[model samples]
Target chain A: MNIGSLLGAIGQGFIWGIMTLGIYITYKILNVSDLTVDGSFATGGAVFAVTALSNIHPTICLFIAMFVGGICGLVTGILHTKFKIPAILAGILTQLGLYSVNLRILGDKANISVAPVSTNITFLANVLNIPHTRAGMLLGIIISIMCILLLYFLLGTEFGASIRATGNNEKMIRALGVNTDNIKLFGIILSNMLIGLSGALLVQMNKYADVGMGKGAIVYGLASIVIGEVFFRRFSNFGIKLMSSVFGCIVFFIIRAFVISLGLKANDMQLLSATIVVIALAMPIFKENINIRKVGKINSLNEMKQVSSSDEIVKEKIEKREVTEVGGGNNA
Target chain B: MLKLKNIYKTFNSGTINEKRALDDINLVLNDGDFVTVIGGNGAGKSTLQNVISGTIMPDFGTVEINGINITKYPEHKRAKYIGRVFQDPMLGTASDMWIEENLALAIKRGENRSAFKWMIDNNNSLFFKEQVAKLGLGLEDRLKTKVKLLSGGQRQAITLLMSTLKKPDLLMLDEHTAALDPKTASLVLNLTDEIVKTSNITTLMITHNMRDALNYGNRLIMMDQGRIIFDVAGDEKKKLTVEDLLQKFNTTKDAPSDAMILG
Candidate 1:
């Protein structure tokens, strides 16, 4: 692909990276695959479009869109927590209902174009004397960093630890006196707010918000998260993990741009995104299976048994050593 | 102190496979009482603890802690006064959390968790390290280690510490060390005794091991088919032996299982 197109793809990737971060909150941290993004994403863009058209300041429009997205998440949360609906089903219900809600927000239109140079990204470019693509990328980087910092701070807080614990072990957290339902609601709301913000940014950059723009958005978000995780597997830092989602999205778009440049149809990109997620998800399992096959090829049964048992013994010895070293350190 | 008055629970009430888990049960625990419960499979031992802990609401009864009736309290709401360690080592802890984080959650039990406060401060970390050091497992320095990496015995010990960290009004352990090897089980059981004794917390621990039931606590109750068939405490419980418990089991409609005999 040409350098210009590659840069444009990277810019789009950063904008969508915000949405991927939103999905990461639900998908990775909360351990719930919330389908509400398909609906909330479109809702975000539509809210931003309608608000920006009213001569509202572009920055304020972004917050408005994010608030509207949180409302969408609240609906899903209520359906899941209060009504006792399954989380995935509740997300689906909200997503399906959002289609009509999005249409209503769009003034009963299928799409609205903000293609005029007065749109925020273009305005930013004009103000800064930079290209529109460059302005979009700059905005994406700024917002993504702010989001990462905010999440890192919040997740380190007491309530945030409870939220993470709720996702990890609902029964255990509940037993420890956390209201898991409330924590879940808060998580969903925070997740969708970021998603809505991403949607607004995407509309600003693309110059249009279509009711169908969020179709299969979950797959794209998952693809970004999965790809990012595959690349940054060794880092356990939460901030780095969050940044990886954005990085994953940028890489995803770069690959897509290159693939499109190879004369692939745009309609085929959804299939490609789904394929990327599947491969990333299965990569660890595939590695394990290959290791098992290698072990199976060992001609001696004693060596095979030793391979399995020796690992555990070695791990135990290492852990024992570490504990003693720490104890010794305290004594000295 | 805890009280269970006229507690009754039935599973699959109308079905052919209907089973009465707890029937017209009544239990009362005095302050500083540590009760060990033993029973055969499906003897409602777990059901009794579940009812007390609000895991399952009794059909007709009231659970009172310090004379405050909590019959309608949800499990999480009642967690403020009650601490529980489950049979499975994995169930009592969030496996992905650090040891210090788990202890932090434990310390915050029954208090409103504020989003503004940092969960792990240096003070609490120091306090936790000191508390863990008392376990004598060399885990005091490994505060940042995730719980999943710990052995079953270590996990149970950590869980025991977490359950008692806040010094709840009541502690309930449902076979907390049953999954460990004999040596580990004994270690955890001794730790349980030390923590309970030091805090003087009211506790109800369930175990399939008859010897442990007899050896650990000041009171022992044997259950059979949804009712407490025998209750002994104080000097009487202290004098009871495994043979006495076996003879008592023989008097029931069903004989003791090999596991109980081995114990």
Candidate 2:
């Protein structure tokens, strides 16, 4: 692939990695299928583009985007937990609602640009006197690293434990006297915040935000998480899992870049992602079945041995009883 | 102490499949009271425990712990006062979490806010280790082991210990030992008795085994349909046999099934 194309792909992939982290938080840590990603992704981009044009600092604009994303997540959590809506349905409702809200945020435009103003990464890149591609990559890497560190610290906290427990087993966590609704809300908010921030960064990197930027975002995120989990299944440690997820996103991007270089059409991206996720999800089930078959064979062998041993024991008991009877007769 | 007054629960209300899971159930458990509940399938044993634990809200009732009415309280809100162990060993604790981590969570039960530190203090860990050592299952040495690695009996033992760690106002055991082998079940039951007696915590244990129901607990309750049909205590409960229980059940209802008799 050409250097520019490669760098462009890498930069885009890096931005997408943030959304993967958000997906990891909701899907892996919280163990909930949140569909709010589609709308929230665009929401982040719109918020960032609109805010940045109004003379706000680009970093602050990103923060505002993340905050809006968190609000969207909070609404989804409220719908699911307090109102007793099914989680998937709640996400769908929120996503549907976000479209109109996103339109309003964009002032009825299908897409918007912050080209005339100081874009976050471009400004930073100019100040640093670095090439746009290098600047984008540098910015993406630093933000991702910071995000990962923040998550690592947060997950180590007590509230984080509660959130993890909520994912693993809500009933057990509730029994621990945790108001799980609060934890769910907290988790959703945090997850969407990262997602929105990623969207904001993408707009700055690409020089514009579009209404359809979030399309297939969920699939992309799922692919990353699945790929990461498949790669890190052997690690029992939580820290390892987190690292693997980040690596998974990067690896997914590299693979996508390779596919594009091989002359695959852009439309094929969705199909490839779907296939990857299917394979990743199916791997565990395939392994489990293989293990079960092995155990079943061992159990049958043990059963046969048990049957023979019981029969031998019964025969020995009968002979002993006969001998005792004969000895008693002789004594008499 | 725990009290349930005129509790009524109907599942799928206003439907063809409507079932009155609990009806006019009035019960009071004094501190240190270990009650064993027995019944056949669909006897409302689990429903009663659920209501008390706030998993299921009673249609009409007042559930009070130490005279505090928690009838309107939600499940997570009521968790502070009530400790519960489910029939499925997997349901009571997070399988992926370390045994110590699970213990830490149980220790923090009822706390308004959890501390930020991941590790408990050395002294607290020592105390938990001591508590775990009492199980005599060598779990004290396996405190760092994930709970998923433990056997059903071992997990149940740990769950029982965890539930009583905070000495909750009321403890509910929903056939917690039913999933284990006979030997392991008896061992857990013995541990239950020792823990309840020593801690002086009020407890409600549901069981499918008639012999266990008769052999354990200070009070024995036999539920039929959706209400308590028989309540026996003290010397009467001590003198009771499996045969006596079978007869009572037969007289109170129809012919008791052989499987019910066996359990």
Candidate 3:
């Protein structure tokens, strides 16, 4: 209810934003579901917690966490590409495998606490010479911005275009002389690494790493991406879109804070989030059907196609566009 | 030069869906031959192109391009040596990408995609504009427009441009104009002829339209049941009429569709 509580939510949102940005690479750009986020997120936290306790530099621990997360993605990529497993199932397999791996990393504990001596909170506050209340928000903003800028630049590169093309038309790009399998592998790895990095940072903000911390991470990530597209889709610039993903999390957290202040129990949060996501996802489909009925003249077949290669969410958008196109045919 | 010797392929082998997509295909093309192929659906026209391009491996064949045996190369790896345009307009280009971005991707078709290179080089923008302008679709002015907005005819035109941009060692067109309207199909065919002749790029084009297959290439080949039923070139090809070709096709139980044979 208070400003402090709201700021705390924003801090949490920023960390989630970072993870979604990682999701954005796979879900939005590469067009892969990459369900490895849940497992990779926990791996990152576990790795970060243990490394930070051993007094390794905080920044170095973050890199280590990211690398470990990337390896998880690589494994999923191999399972999908080399072993011919479906992408989502490949990610689920890795996620399930990482459960045991996460236990070992946590020294068989379900949770590990990084106490007051940890380098993430108070240590960061001392370095910045600011109060603990303000340190997290400031760090979150700065790091998120840095991550955004990096993504903006990378996606604009030739290789980045190839990644986008891979999601868009795997066969076309393949005919263009790109080994799409390798491109897919790189995309999955990069996405998981970013998720891992975000997970490591999220644990520090909470001052603890729990085995279950990453549960429903994909839902959270997808919610942020869908919300960002819903609210800020007007801006097509890659950088602004990336910022919008983070901005969406901030808005979502703020909304949660308002709802909680209105007397909603904390236990209802997950249910509320799930419902919101369901609506966000189905809104396009429902709208598309409505448009079809409105037109009333469309044929059974209207040249719609399954060409976007991947991204279940984007596939919905494709259908939405097809129906809209049918209605818009006369206007054009 | 391109060569295919003893290429054999069977899909869904030993099943109810079993099909011999390719059967002992042996072909040789000297540089800049500009051949056209015609066949009905399931005639293995696409399979022959796919085998040469490595889209599908031949069961028993050595595909040699320019005297190098490239049967073992993957599809993308073979891309450095060939250019291809598919029948479906959507299959040849990425729709969501900008007109120029698609060209930039084609420009890097055979090169290693570098992380540091700008996606579309500024220096090449003018060249792209010129190339797009040459399409005469007014696409030059709208280089930044997503390809999705382009009409089927316009997309086919750009796809043709992309295929020949590098003067590929061999250019393959698989019914590239079938999706276009009559007027646009002729326009694209003319463009295809212009691009092929100027570059002198050895090319193979497949068409259901009998006239396009007969008129567009120096050599004309017909396939039926995965076998090249007829092959003719130069004066012999030029003298042939649509009726003669249809007559040749009728000799086989499986024949081209009436619409295609009569086109």
Candidate 4:
């Protein structure tokens, strides 16, 4: 990739990093494979576009988007916890419902584009007088760092400890006097809030919000997390694990940029990303299976060698006994 | 103090699989009473504890702790007054968590968990180290180690420590040492004796081992077919022999099983 393209990829990666962080909470901390991101991400963008059109401050629109995204999470949480719906199904239900919600927020439009001279432009670009791409990159770095610190602090608290414990062992945490349902709800809400914020930032960066903006978003988030884990597997520090998501996202976007330059169609990228995630997730299991087969082969070979050696010893002993019998007969 | 009055539970009601787990069960435990429960399989020993701990609600009963009716309380809500360790060591702890983190959760068992308050601080870390040192397993320095890495015996010991850390109103041990080897089981039993004596906490322990049921607690009760057939305490309990108990069992029901006699 050229220098400019690489920089652009990094910038987009940072913005997506916020979404990855949200996925991390549900996927890692809450131990729930929440599929609400695709809907919540678009909800965020839709909220941002509608509010910005009404002349709300662009920065304030970010928080508004987050609030709306969190509502989307609340719906999923209630469905999963209270209505007894399976987690994945609950998330799918929300994602499905958000389709019409997003359209309504966009005034029945399929997409909405920010004018080139509109105030919907991000504060970093306006205040710093920098190029749009550079502003996004800087903003992403600043916001991601702030998010990392906040999460680090939050996870260290008593409530955060219970959330982690709930993810680790639901029964144990419940037995310890924690209402696991409440903790799960809080986790889902917080996760989607961050995802919503990421969506708002992306809408501002691309200067447009489309109804299908968040298609395949969950796979992207999972890929970022899986790739991040491969890099930070050895580190038990919570902060380092969170940072790995951003780094992974940056690498993922860089790879995408390079593949696009190689003449790959954008339509084919979804299949490619899904395949990458599947391979990454299955890597450890594959290694374990291979090791087990190797050990099994060696063990069987050893058993066969022992059986053959013992047979030879028994035959040699019988031969010696026969010779002794013949020699004794001659003495007689 | 704990009370279970008129407790009745029937599993698979009205079906061929229907079985009465607890039938008209009534139990009352005074403060600091350590009661050892002994019974064979399907004898309602575990069902009684489960009823008290809110794992399953009785079809008909009023469960009370210190005069407060908790029959309708959920398991997590009842946990404010109850502490439990399961037969399976894995059920008692979050294996992936650090030793200190687990202990921190235990220490706040009945307290409000604040969002902004730090779970582990320097002061609490030192306290946890001291508490772990008392286990005498050389685990004081390994506070950062995950609980999954510990042996079954070690995990049970930690679980025991956690259950009693907050001085819960009632402690329930459902065959806590049944999963450990004999040596580890005896060690854990001894530790249990020491902790109960030191803290004077009210406890209910269920076990199949007759000798253990006789040896450790202040009182002993035998259950058969969802009923407490025999209850003994004070000098009568202290002076009773294994032979006397077996003879009592022979008269009350069938002859004692070989496992019960050997135990």
Off by over 4 Å in 2: A2-8, A284-332, B12-18, B119-123
Compose the digit string of candidate 2's lDDT tens values, residues B88-111: 998888887888878877887867
Which of the numbered candidates is closest to the native, going by highest DockQ? Answer: 3
lDDT of 1: 0.90
Of the two candidates 2 and 3, the one with more favorable lDDT, higher being better, is 3
Question: Model 3 segments beyond 4 Å from truth?
Answer: A291-332
Report RMSD for candidate 1.
5.9
Could you tally the backbone clashes for each prediction?
0, 1, 0, 0
The per-model DockQ list reads 0.44, 0.35, 0.62, 0.54
lDDT of each: 0.90, 0.85, 0.86, 0.87
Q: In candidate 2 chain B, what residue range of length 10 has the lowest lDDT sum?
A: B112-121
Label model 4 with its docking quality class.
medium
Model 1 shows how many backbone clashes?
Answer: 0
lDDT of 2: 0.85
